[model samples]
Target chain A: MLRLHGIVGDRRDHALHHRLHHLEHHDAIEFLFVPEADLGRRRLRALTDRGTECAVSLDRDDALYDGAVLFIDDDRAVVVRAGAPRELRLRPQGTEGALKLGFLAGHLHWRVRFEGTDLCVVLDGAAADYTARIAPLLDDGIVTVVGNAN
Target chain B: MNAPALSPATPAKTAPAARVGIGGPVGSGKTALVERLIAAFAARKVDLAVITNDLVTHEDAERVRRSGLIDPARVSAVEAGACPHTVIREDPTLNIEAADDLERRFPGVELILIESGGDNLASTFSRDLTDFWIFVIDVAGGDDIPRKRGPGVLKCDLLVINKADLAPHVGVDLDGMIAEARRVRAGRPVIVTNCRRSEGIDAVADHLEREVLFRT
Candidate 1:
């Protein structure tokens, strides 16, 4: 299990904007003092060893986690796992690919709700008809509990 | 305190230009209520856009788009995927993105009314998502509704008592319902409307002017 604690008190929150603007400046990168941000080094190492460029989340809201499939290193835009993250790993059919998915699935605070055709979506909180939809996603590994911070 | 240094320097995101949310139980005239607000706001030259969520399809959004009240492009539909409250309240990132996209496409838009997929008496909007939100419940829904004190009834900025025209037919007392709603809300604001005939829309718009646009 990846233990990423100390995020609640970290000042990295202030630098997200600066990094978002700078080419060399990366938001959530070198900005995270939170120990809970890292997925276990073993999994990330195995994937990188197989040439899969992996990114761990530095904050919860860079995107809502309800239906998150994977994070990309290039732009960090979350995608529905359209086999895109698999392609990032030069070896598509290796343990590295499966391990990445494992790390994502194991995370409880990742905040995603799985839907039709296995579409993992960033959960919507404002909708009135939202409860009925999230009920089942909670049962599927697709939905996870996340975002305890203010 | 270092207020400026604590928050991002970027311009704070303002509330969407035009957002009017119609929330009520299934068939309390949420869609019909939206149609009337569209026509009323339009009559005043308020540029507008709309969003609707349904159980499984574009049923609500498509209905409005076909009404010819507004351009089809101005109307967008979001599938609730089951949870209606979540899309409008807790984490409204998707709705925010949709409203932002609408504002980008139609810079002239003065309002974007978000109609919640019909929900129960307990539903309400989060301030983070909307500058102003209106809750629609009908006299026919029962005068006891206001007395029950659901969050949607009490918390909305404006509590709209719709379907007033049908009150007598359904044995509802419009006057008493309005009085009770006012009492429960601690006299914030309430409007009665017969959306089917466009009655009482002016009061609703007037409330918007005073409360949302600060026209007063």
Candidate 2:
């Protein structure tokens, strides 16, 4: 298993981006897709798209972000790609219910947006976990789970 | 002048300190327990640091720093704002950053005691923030507390029943409270302590040394 200690650069860096583009033409770019929740973790073990096993142990203060470049060599490059954002769509029963639901989401610091009458919440973890926090509102019919937005 | 050259990524030189969280209701002796543990670990010659999450003020952090049990510089304070539980459990980025700063400053630190602001029984420490956590409850809070089975009590690595000396005055049966706590925790470790008198503190330190630090 190859042990990755830190991020060399990110794809957003122009030099690295150009290098990645050049490497792609040679079929030498591999990607590791990391989930949103796991980004904050300092230690992780995952396999690349080509089935190469690697262990990542970042510094205490460092967090993994999208497009992190883990390793690069003359022949190949390894990059990290964050998974797609997962979200839950909810509809409150009334104005008061919307206020309460909004308050709860704000208190929990959940990233959310309003779309028509629905509240779309970007989830950091499982959808069930977010719903569980608002279970009382659901049981009382103050809010209803419309569906997954993504 | 020569241009600086890029260096290859290097692994972290040392492991981060073990983080332990102490959480409980208002006036449940969370700060008192932190002070006591500071003394206990100091006596054991363990390198330590502390982070206190005060709801609106730095009162708890100031108190710990003034105790003189550890270096004042080693103590860090985090304002948890209105949501105490949220800072420790939901969005613990502030606390994580504080702990990381302490580790960076004190490389020899073996443990960091994170004291949460007083909160409700539903409060818990996120696994990403704490390696081990203890929920502190007092006898005066009522003997029914354990039977209520809040997540903080049921899920903590250790449960502490503080202010045991007040059990008689508060009409709380200490033995029954301990038994009920053990029952709710499904036979997990529970230690009774009177922080004012420093009683049963060694037991708590022993548990930390064995379970968290793996010193045993």
In terms of lDDT, the best-performing candidate is: 2
User: Residues A51-139, candidate 1, lDDT per residue (tens digit)?
Assistant: 23232222212321222323223332222111112101111124443344334433422233333223232222332233234444444
Q: Where does model 1 sit among the CAPRI classes?
A: incorrect
- Over the stretch B137-207, how does candidate 1's per-residue lDDT look in tens digits? 98878889999999999888788888898888989888888899999999978988888888888888877
Model 1 residue A85 distance off true place after TM-score fit, in angstroms: 55
Worst 10 residues of 2 chain A by lDDT: A37-46
- Best-matching candidate per DockQ: 2
lDDT of each: 0.58, 0.84
DockQ of 2: 0.05
Q: Candidate 1 chain A, which ten residues in sequence have the lowest lDDT sum? A: A82-91
Q: Give me the overall lDDT of model 2.
A: 0.84
Off by over 4 Å in 1: A1-150, B1-16
The 10 consecutive residues of candidate 1 chain B with the worst lDDT sum are: B1-10
lDDT tens string, model 2, A1-150? Answer: 455667889887999998988876665666777877557655566776556666665666677888899888766677887886567999999888899998898777565667999988866468889999999999999899997745
DockQ for each numbered candidate:
0.01, 0.05
CAPRI rating of model 2: incorrect
Interface RMSD for candidate number 2? Answer: 12.3
